[model samples]
Target: MAEYMRLRQICLVAPQLAPVIADISAIMGLDVCYRDGNVAKYGLENALLPVDTILLEVVAPFQPGPGTAAGRFIEKTGGRGGYMAIFACEDPDARGAKANAMGVRTANVITHAPYHGVQLHPRDCRAAFIEFNHTDGSDDILGPYPPAGPDWQKSIRKDTTLSLTEVEMQSPEPEGLAAHWGRIIGIPADGPVVKLPNNTFRFVKGDSEIMSGLTFKVVDKAKVLEAAKARGCAVKGDEFLLSGVTFKLTA
Candidate 1:
């Protein structure tokens, strides 16, 4: 089995992409890295933001077609909150095979083309697009998954203060979801909090069986909430307003 790196990114979808991107930037203090042109096939556009090298991507559908599955994902999840959680892997193929061994099928495999990526079904992950990917020959993880084009580093801008940091997950069956993800990623699923070298995955159960709402680690969780509140975003405990997406703050 191949060892993996820290958590890489989390993807969010919006009915429209630009506003959400703006919202995340204004609210979270993150810088937009670039938008990937390849997403045009799925009738979608995307922007990548760096939170300590953990990519935060916001995507919106521009048109529905063969390549973009954003439409189907939106329809299935009734819009948005947290769409996908992507992680770094030393060997995507090896990890992909591990997932397959556990009865989880790969949804797609993106290779050499730039980055090597493999996605597992959400059902297997309990409602999330779990991707394990690595860029060939370089530990410069962010550069491989180009936000705009295949020029490699053109899309990645490192933020020394920003760390991929932490991820919070809300699921109806927290333990079950964690365990399921553990099998998929070869990580232990024993607690509410699963910590990695550069990040953490925290799980909490809610009323519905579906997973929802996520919190990303920021420099100041309180400041993020205050900023959002001032901008007319509703704040309830750790989460803020819903505009097809829910942003939460957790330490």
Candidate 2:
């Protein structure tokens, strides 16, 4: 199999899933694809929605405490931000090994039958958790993705939101953070941007290093913004704050 990697999923952390999930679905005109029971083992409850081919997931800690990673992240960020950037790759272990060599410690390794994933430490990764995963005999982008659940594609709705175009990673030292992420992902940084096949990661100046925003292509930008306002989102210009990240809509 030829080697390749792409942004497969973006996971956001929330204290509770209620309002966040509801607001996103209403504003973006998206449908919930799945709520993985597997996460319950880790004291988490999650919901995944398909944003074109990219899965958008929100996870909340049911058992909030220092023992739960999600709970700690919520307290650390004051309940504002994305959690992880999960990439679909040809070789997960190889990617983990490379990240480890760069002093990015491996946080966890998940293996369930045909699927395998490696999660790197968030502190070392800088902004968010970096995870590389692969499913055996499935190189096709739309093939059997175990995390998004079976028949996730059937729930895809593009009436309002067209596609996720860019992820905005913010840091005081934007260029340096971009270069670090580039090295981990094996993609050389182009100035302050890391351009992937389907999406781009734009590093920008901010108070702290974090996944701060997401840019989306929409069928009707104004309509989406109006929906966001109705859902009581804090709207400013072309963007609205939801699930702790700015959702920027473009026509």
Candidate 3:
């Protein structure tokens, strides 16, 4: 059953979704797919990209409550956006059952007529939201989402463009956090990194995004920093702020 789960999407939540979307686009030279309607009933708005058939979405909440989900996330971590790695399942209902059997409760379930998605509590994953969903009336997993407006393929076309590889996680106790996430994702602890079939998750002891969960790919790390600087982006170590979002580069 665990093998049946597949990587689906990566979401980044911000206080203002639009600005973050714009920031990533300018730095990456890609366009975002603005869906026609809200994906969540919680007043969350989004923009998406088809990153190797895995949707990458940036989302934000319109209101407040412990942080409108998106808002709450910003308040908790001070707006350093990270990935909310979603997974595809054979059956969302059965997945929910599995989670319940494991004593994990679904955070929110959405039945938006044509699509069904459930957000697992962040407490379950720590530092991120994990969503599972199966759409109705279509096997077009990435098709329903719009094109990212430009030839995103071109960004990767360059030999220097490294794939925005894996996300890293950081906690007070690196070993404990690694083991905990290993159980959730069915991956084993490999030294400081938890090795999953699709992605490698590294765990460290720190609160910074550079030490914690961050999105990376295979671009000329130095070149990305240089390009970001040319665009008036603020740099802090390897992480850069452009448009209002942060992009961290790693091998």
**Quick one: best lDDT, which candidate?**
2
Residue pairs whose backbone atoms clash in candidate 2: none
Choose the strongest candidate by TM-score.
2
Across 76-170, the per-residue lDDT of candidate 3 in tens digits comes to 77766464767666577776666666666788887765567777777766667767776553354433422232343332233443344566666
Pairwise lDDT winner, candidates 1 and 2:
2
Error of 1 at 29 (Å): 1.8
lDDT of 2 at 64: 71
* Candidate 1 RMSD to the real structure: 3.4
Off by over 4 Å in 1: 64-68, 140-164, 209-211, 217-223, 242-246
Better of 2 and 3 by TM-score: 2
Against the true structure, what is each candidate's TM-score?
A: 0.83, 0.98, 0.76
lDDT at 28, model 3: 60
Which of candidates 2 and 3 reaches a greater lDDT? 2
| Residue 77, model 3, lDDT | 71
